[model samples]
Target: MSAPSSRSPVIDTVKGLACMAIVWHHLAFYGPMSDIAQPLAPGLMAFLYDYARMAVQVFLVVGGYLAAASLAPAGTARFAHAGSAIGKRFVRLMVPCAVALVFTVVVSALVRTWMNHPSVPEAPTLAQLVANALMLQDLLGEDALSAGVWYVAIDFQLFSLSVLAWAWVRALPGRWPQQQRAALARGLIVAGAAASLWFFNRVAGLDMWALYFLGAYGLGMLAYWAVQSSRPHGWLAAIVLLGGVALALDFRGRIAVALVAALGLALAQRMQQTHSAGRTLPGWADGLARVGQMSYSVFLVHFGACLLVNAVVGTLWPASAPINALGMVLAFALSLVAGRWMYLRVEQHVPSWATALRWQAGLVGTGLLVALLSNGV
Candidate 1:
């Protein structure tokens, strides 16, 4: 019998987990693990630093795939069509960002109040907020407006790039059928991904700026194109692409491991939908949908929580690596709880709150801009 049709909560759970991983990494790396997770810490800590964030690349790649798949149907978004997708993304990201910025400011403010320490910087100005409002903060050499603005900024930049690429493809042979166009697009995307990695490590010294937003997003686009195309070959292509990344970058084994884990999860989800397991997955699907829903918020706020926890831990615990490691554990516990709270309250308000205010979670777009303006950058 065909595998029961199933829904994939795995993806959503992965997103949620990835956010937590980032949180732990930041907390451990900056706060305690240097001493704690280092010699005292296990190899897993090292593995995460080396490879876990690459899992984030998986998210980006998948997003790119799904986006391209959607675009395959519509071809591409025009200026008008682009507005809503871009706008919604903006809202989703900015809301949690705003909340984090406010939370950070409050924390910063409290520190100043208690310590009377003039050493800490004040909140950012209106001009800075304006820049962040347009998602220009990161591009302008500003520190992340909060902590995780990179993900949103990069994703948006990639989305824009994808649209442009699609436009260019459309202009060429201007009448090629979708199949041929998709194949060409996939080839181009792979080439671009390779070029992106090469240029980043070799040319830009692995600087984030030199990397192509499209390349990362394009990875997903390419995958989606393959999975949805006549050949429908996602699994093998992902392995090949990741292999290229490994060989070219001299990636440690952790990255390869992350790639497999992520791909397996993606495939499992796909199988649940397409196979006989489909019925076994609706609950997971619904749950994942919820997790996916809160992903943007978690991504934005998790790091800041880490920072705060790191600071407090450093202030209270041993400054040495071992002591800092303890702090990281504490931070993880705190951030996990705090992250969930922010998602539930700040990012994921109840239906009543949403309906009562007649708000569509859209206010977060403006709110984040305000926080950015309020924070120094």
Candidate 2:
């Protein structure tokens, strides 16, 4: 195991940049507002629309890296309480996600009333609402209530699967020597990852399942393990070799992106570990790091922000290029502000207060449903 260092500003910076990119992409890729903005810079909007979604790879790799660090920092595969770990992860993700879903539901309904834009989601059904609250929309074959929310479900799946894999390793027969057991555990994990990359990842039919994305997620875990290896060159070489084989088997742009992100994170980890104490980020980088910290909240609320902005802009200007363009910019800026607000006001409170908040949110949702039914809405 390696000694932990201060949080890397670089990772946070990457996250910040990615968050901005995603918001920009969404603003430029969806709705009549984007239609107005597109003519202003068609080429740039097209490129961002086509490619900005790849930023998700960065988050996936980072998630895997952090999961490994928390669950098996030593790569010992000793997960004494995998269930507890999974429960904690679910709460951390779901509490904020559910709250965000409620916001999405309300904003979507408002937009539907104000505009006939293609981007506005339909009035959310009770079943769809329940599925989204549980983050099972993808697996349950329900339409998503919000843009980019599928990633939240995938994040939970990846964490749960990784922990369960470790638990399975821990449950293996006890007669084996400790060293042998550890080696076997690591080998099994690698095997699963390799299978995912070579086989499951190629099956488009399975994309909704956790295993479909596990290939990239596993590459992240492998990156962490490689960086921690005593035989650095050999470990890295093996990682490169395995990744090469996976690509050779079937080239996937997203997987390739994930591999690159994993390598970048590993390199950053190496540099940070080698550096002495007192390493600090410059002012701009520190600002980006703050964005990274609130990236999840930003991601969650940005759709709602965009919807509200679109309704207002459409009412006032109705596709006048300049005003809509300005609205796009306003939407982007306000998303950051709202994301920070949500993070500070809601997400940060989840650790000690999630249970209370969950109940409160449920009651609110129930009351809203009753009122809607009463009005025949």
**lDDT of the candidates, in the order given:** 0.54, 0.76
* Highest TM-score model number: 2
Report the number of backbone clashes for model 2. Answer: 0
| Backbone clash numbers for all candidates listed | 29, 0
Candidate 1, superposed: residue stretches over 4 Å from native = 1-7, 32-51, 73-80, 112-128, 171-176, 205-213, 233-246, 249-266, 279-293, 311-327, 345-377
Number of the top lDDT candidate? 2
Q: What does candidate 1 score on TM? A: 0.70
lDDT of 1 at 329: 73
Each model's TM-score?
0.70, 0.91
- CA RMSD (A), model 1: 6.7
Which 10-residue window of candidate 2 scores lowest in summed lDDT?
1-10
Runs in model 2 with CA error above 4 Å?
1-6, 77-79, 352-377
